[model samples]
Target: MPHPNPDAMAFLLSRRSRPAKTLRAPAPDRAALEPILTAAARSPDHGKLEPWRFIVLERGALHRLAGLVEERGPDLGQDADQIAKAASAYRDSPLAVVVVEIQKSSEKIPQIEMTYSAGAVCLALLNAALASGWGANWLSGWASHDRAFVEQGLGLSADERVAGIIHIGTETSAPPERPRPDLDTITEWVTE
Candidate 1:
């Protein structure tokens, strides 16, 4: 026998991501966030290879990362607007959890499967944050793709890449509901 949790199901159906810019303090403290992290860790991994990691960026770290974005912009050939956009993520976020994909060298699990596992972790973290009563958004910008930025800013390994930056904080305003895909148009039922 299985017990059904309708509230959880409903929450998943209605949950929306709050814009990172609109997220304000006070964000979840370590004690409050631990369970959410644990929930996020429950994401599927084909070979039980935890090929993902998280880096929690607190207030000071955000400022430092912002400065790194500004400093690295010229070298990366990023225009002023692009630099500002990259820097703004740190400037605006009250708290951010950087999910990193640590690609494992294994014959059994394909590289793409490892990437997929990392992607699953990102979504899990986002959903966990939302379920924990905090607004959350998963983001990645040009900064995420720049090797220098990843290495210097977050000290990521050569095989590691930024999967997402999960920003969590209080919602300043509710985001308007957007149109969802029509299920019938996307789903198919097959019977033989």
Candidate 2:
């Protein structure tokens, strides 16, 4: 018989991500966040390449990024409203974890696989934070995708990209449940 973990199964079934903007102060400090990071690092990695890393953005780092958004927004062709929205995320966030996807050179393992692994890590980290009794949301905005923003602000390497930015903190209010996918419409069975 397969092992059963009813609580774990239930948690997975009911897991809901809190909105990033709704996350408040009192985020887990470094010592408290280490375990969550450790959990994220355990995600599956093809070829054992470990093609992902974490950058925990504390208050000061978040402020710096917020400032960068204002200073760099116009250069990137972002208008005032866009800049404000982008900057607010960093400016108001209690804490965030930047998941950096590292592209490793491997013959058998494709680069796409590495990118997938990084994405998996992002989900794992988000789940970990949620499971640890913190509100968490995974996000990637226009600024995150901007090469200059990522390179100059976060100092990502040439071969690296932002897979996700997981904002975690106290929940100001429980988010109302939204519509979920209809599995019947999305799933297809295959047999040979």
Highest-TM-score candidate: 2
- Look at candidate 2 and give me any clashing residue pairs: none
Estimate, for each residue in 95-190, the C-alpha lDDT of model 1 and write its tens digit: 999999999889899989988988999999999999989999999998889999899989999999999999999999999999999999999999
**lDDT of candidate 1 vs native?**
0.94
* RMSD in order of candidates: 1.1, 0.8
- Which regions of candidate 2 deviate over 4 angstroms? none
Compared with the true structure, model 1 gives a TM-score of 0.96
Error (Å) of candidate 1 at residue 4 is: 2.6
- Predicted candidate 2 versus true structure: per-residue lDDT over 63-99, tens digit per residue: 9999999998899889999999989999989999999
| Candidate 1: clashing pairs of residues | none
| Candidate 2 lDDT for residue 160 | 92
Evaluated at residue 30, the lDDT of candidate 1 is 99
Against the true structure, whose lDDT is highest? Answer: 2
lDDT of each: 0.94, 0.95
